[model samples]
Target: MKRWWIGTTAALMLIAAGCAGGTDAKSGTNRHDRHTSGQAMPAFVEQSTIPHVREAYAFAEANADQLQYIPCYCGCGSLGHESVKSCFIAGKKANGQLEYNVHGSGCEICVNVVMDAKKGIEAGKTLQEVRQQIEQKYGPQLSPTNTPAPPEGK
Candidate 1:
């Protein structure tokens, strides 16, 4: 059916958009197709073919500052990850470039946590609400990262 084909095509396009992409720090044309920010994706992320892995990595990098307040519940605490952000970002370099956490590129629990946070935010939840929701959802069965609660009052 034509409708089926169109729906399938749209889904494929969405999947393709979430794929790991190469970057060109110079030329504009024929550059990174998924994200044209001119910054290369970490090799670890680029090695993944899973759309969610790539999508979550991109989201984690772009929202690093905010994610610091969101806890990741996957026992990453034992790994010294202080917050959800630490699952994806090890730290910044002297020049301000993010040092990617290779663990992020492979961990489904980390990616799912980030994705859930994003969905909550997009659905009009406040940061506090989002944090609480994630905690309530995962706290019972998993160990959470050392992320602190959102700064008191806003």
Candidate 2:
């Protein structure tokens, strides 16, 4: 009877320890908490249209501050995208690590914008210069509309 009691007590203690191991003592939250920096990571799309989308995402995360000043001409501003940076990053962690947004993977335009910014940075262009070049190329076309009306009548 004494041996049985001791074994049961040890089993109970092991179970308690296992449960305790999964929680943070200070925060009282799960130890595997996904929150990094201050933002919760956004769910990335399962598939990307471009093969190089992952590289574009990393580039955007690494150069977010610079990309933030560059605007996107794809009309994504309606989706709350203020700058090219918004195409990739949702927010930053306290340690400065980026929480990425999934928008870039699905939108070729966003990915292209990031790629262009990366190229500009690699070419030693200042942010202002890059912004100017992008604006000149993609800003309002020569005419208000680049495409003519479909046809006089179908």
Candidate 3:
């Protein structure tokens, strides 16, 4: 009987620890957090769609203000430097020329947003409309209030 009581107590403790996130493995953080310390993006993305990728990056850079209204895709709680810059470097030369080696850590998200924005632009969707589409698609994962503001003017 005493052994049974001891076993039950240990089991309960384990269950409680797991529920409270006291286990050896922690799962709250993700790639975006890892990037916040100011890391660089990758150097190769889908080759066939460079222009589309560049457009998306351009859109994000142009709409820094709108970042406050959207979220990032890296699973980071809020927008960080890496997420924002990834948009700019998704697919372009370091000198802003055509470059095939361009890559970005958050390129997938940036690419998707950029593609959507380009489609919107081609469809005569204003910048605001395109931004709205991006927010609608990626907002839930982004931290609207945490995004940093851009320069003072333009």
Compare the candidates by TM-score and give the number of the best one: 1
How do the predictions measure up, each by TM-score? 0.74, 0.59, 0.37
Candidate 3 vs. true structure, TM-score: 0.37
Candidate 1 residue lDDT tens string, 8-50: 9999988777554434446433344333234566767878755
lDDT, candidate 3, 3-86, per-residue tens: 999999999999876666432335343322222222322233323344455445444445434433333454443333334344
Q: Give candidate 1 misplaced runs (Cα > 4 Å).
A: 1-30, 33-37, 49-51
Q: Which one wins by TM-score: 2 or 3?
A: 2
The candidate that wins on lDDT is 1
Model 3 spans > 4 angstroms off: 1-43, 46-72, 75-86, 90-106, 144-154
Tell me the whole-model lDDT of each prediction, alpha carbons only: 0.79, 0.67, 0.46
| Structure candidate 1, residue pairs in collision | none
Taking the candidates one at a time, how many backbone clashes does each contain?
0, 3, 3
lDDT of 3 at 1: 100
Clash pairs, model 3 backbone: 56-114, 71-142, 72-142
Question: Least accurate stretch of 10 residues (summed lDDT) in model 3?
Answer: 33-42
- After aligning candidate 3 to the native by TM-score, how far in Å is the CA of 148 from where it should be? 8.0
